[model samples]
Target chain A: MKDKQNLTGNLGALVKNFSNLHSIEPDSMLDLNTTTFLQKLVSKDVIDAGVRVKPKDYLKSLVLLEYFSGIIEGDYMACKNLAKISEKIRKIEDEEDTSVDPHERDSYLTLPVVIAEAALCANEKEDTYSDNASLKKIKVRYQNHDMKIDLHSPKSKKPEPYYDMIGQMVLDVTSKSVEHYLEKVSSRAELSSLIFTGHALDMIKSDSQKSKVKTALEKKDYFSASLEALKGIMKDITISVIDEYISNLEG
Target chain B: MGKKVVQGGELLFKEDIIIDEEAVRMQLTIPSRIPIFSIDEMQVFYNSHVFTLTKNSSKDAMIKVYTTEYGLNEEKSPKLQEDEYFKANTAEVNKLKEEFIKKAVIGMPDNCYDKSLEKQACLTLVEKINHAYDIAEHSYKAPPSKGLVPKLSDDSIFNTYIGDFERAMLLDGKVYRLETIQEYLSMFQKAIEPKFYKELEKKSVLMTPEEAFKELTDNRHKIHPWGFPFIRNKIWYNEKSFKIFLDGIYWIPKFASTSKNAEEKYRNAIERKIKTDAAEEGFGK
Candidate 1:
């Protein structure tokens, strides 16, 4: 019990440090071995003290902790899904080319993608041992490595006690999405067309309206004139475009 | 015949005398050897019917009398009929009345009755009234001129009221010289007007719509609706004006840059460049 308590305290401190660093750059690099360290801590004998906690909670917390720490690649399927989306955005921006010097464009694109992906995976499934098998399968696919994930393996006999952890994961991902969007566009006009379009789309109630708003946004009419139109349609909506997009992906 | 009885209007023993008391009556004849006295002595003799003669051998005899009448009488005494006392007393009373009228003419001067001067006059009037009461108890009278009197109808009216002394001295109309009671009232009215007008003007200006709007804008965050309704509705539509307004809103530090980090970087670079240039020019030394 004492060991688990110490581990929880350590996790909290790590989360705080990660947030502080994340604020400096939305996609700042983090230590790669963070998951290994977390795994080791959870393996302590005092982990039995966490028996009352559902496995879903524990898995959720682990996923959320990894997301906030900027440790996107992990054994969990949710973490892997988030990483895949981040990779796609980085690939589009050509962030991994060592020959290319670091630039604002890469950071801007990668940060939003990572945030969106994390939020989506976090929102999808609740934690269960059966879910982990599917999760491991997704994670293996995400790695693009030779290791195979066996979904048909015998399920664990006892119910895990970490469902609360999954809930935390969703919260963390949502927060990251907001933080990243704010980092990119502190000013209203600095918002990208994709984000703006997403927001405008969210405002639409019907398919026709969605198409119309999308068309208006694409033509850059949204910046020049469509803000009032958008306001009229969605007077009560408070979420920003990027946030809405991330939330949709998560949902 | 021990001594002769003399009367104010008669020579010694010359006049026929009659005496009567209760039921008795008597008459006597007079000797006319003595000369008739002067008119005054005769008047005295008539006034006092009883007179006494003091003997200094017969050659130096003197007569004296007591009289009830002191001034002109219609009958018996001809010399006392003149109206000198009446004329003298009336003249003295008239001279005193004229002096009282002269003292009542205190007031502010013509040039001193302007807007600013009116306030000063009010204060001065109050002080003078106080002083007047302290010195003269009964004789002090306030000025009668309406213009000179400070207007106490409304708060601002008293601002125009001039001092009582100035009114008494300078005002052309009837001087209602400030007496004890009126002086105190003038002082109070004068003192209260300026303060009242100041407060009234302040309230009027503050209550104006422009002032209220300014106050609203100052504490706007507290009262601002969820959204900037004015900007969203009225100001946002007009292209040219909206652009200017957006520029104004977006130009603030929080929203100007794509990110707060970018602004900090830009500022740092600018500062560094300025420092480098200064060093090159030997200005830093």
Candidate 2:
């Protein structure tokens, strides 16, 4: 009972602090956060006590408070406190003398765990997406069609232009094949001008593109000519596009 | 506020904790330009790796129990009495990882081709295509084309898979040759042009072997690099990032699988096993 009182007191303080910081009423948000967190906790089998104050409310309040406080004040301890509180709950659950599953225990790390932990607590439907513009500064988002989650660092001020170099074409502009280059430019222009006339090509457009394609084909640089043709039609030469194009051709 | 800790019988006052700013900044940050994967592929990814790392093994074990319980009789489910659940979970995780890795290949750029490394490149590309990745495997079994004639269907089929993408990019793993790379690139250039398809339409069959071979022979400089299609989905994690993700799984308790009530099921299974053993011992006595 004493432990439960302390848990409630801590939760209340956290709720008041978080609500004040966000400049919003605590009633509704607190309820939603508590419900979400509680459901997750129950599913995990972390709560062993028979009759109790909802431990998830305390966890949710602490998590929200730590998250906003860490970002806004840059006070790292606020985040650490969230972990400590979780540890405390685990300890409480463990004291019940029931056999515990090894997988149910909390796994702790020094640094990167903070981001994933914060992300786990993030509710997609909540106001965190819209109200907190600073949230974008962090990399935590539901990715892989919202099936997987990932987190990374924010962009720095450096002129680091990032690109997914894996499946993209690397166009070379510096080669000294002036005649070949001019031929490529002309062929590219010809291929690009043809309109998408449904899935199959129209006769006239097909004839024009094919002639340029054949001329390019006759030249030593068939690869560049093929790229121009695909890029012109697909508007982008990506693996997925190529795959889809092939699928259509096969069909 | 500082917290006091008794360490080795000496009381110590702890000050503010400093987060490793450098470590956090240096995380394997994938650029956003990477194309995201389809949902089906993402499902494959989660079923393979994430479930094990995130400690969803118990739930997975319960799922096996239920799958066996409902699909087959419970008599056949427990291969072993003591560690049956653990063994089942581990086996599934290992099998999935192996399956996924077989389909995974390192990201390849156009610049990966080198004349000096031709043999190695050819071997690696062929190995990946024939065994590891096998992107062309399904096309071999692809149904016949609608517009093309029966006699020329083989050519159309060849054009559909070999002549188009894999042959255009890989050329049966001989991408090291300058001519081969040029031909690969030219194949793509021609495929997009309206005239390329127009020519295809003119033929009763997709291609003659010589024609396909001629088309496959074009080369400019090189072809674009292709990573796995799921790379954009952030499914392709670097080694360090993979460890980080596994570490991250520890902190997110809510991700714990609760749907199956796995712990209860596990405990019940164990109890049943114990009771059965005791009954057998008593009968022997």
lDDT of 2 by residue, A1-251 (tens): 55433333332222221111221111111221222323321211222211112222234233323323332222344345345644654554443332432223332221213322233233222344344563443212201111211112132111100110100011111112222232222221111111111111111134565455446545634333433343233321223432342344346
TM-score of each: 0.15, 0.16
Per-model tally of clashing residue pairs: 49, 17
For model 2 the local lDDT of residue A26 reads 14
Docking class of 2: incorrect
Model 2, residue B100: what's the lDDT? 29
Number of the top candidate by lDDT?
1
Cα deviation in Å at residue B283, candidate 2?
81
Prediction RMSDs, each to the true structure: 48.6, 34.9
Interface RMSD of each: 57.6, 24.1
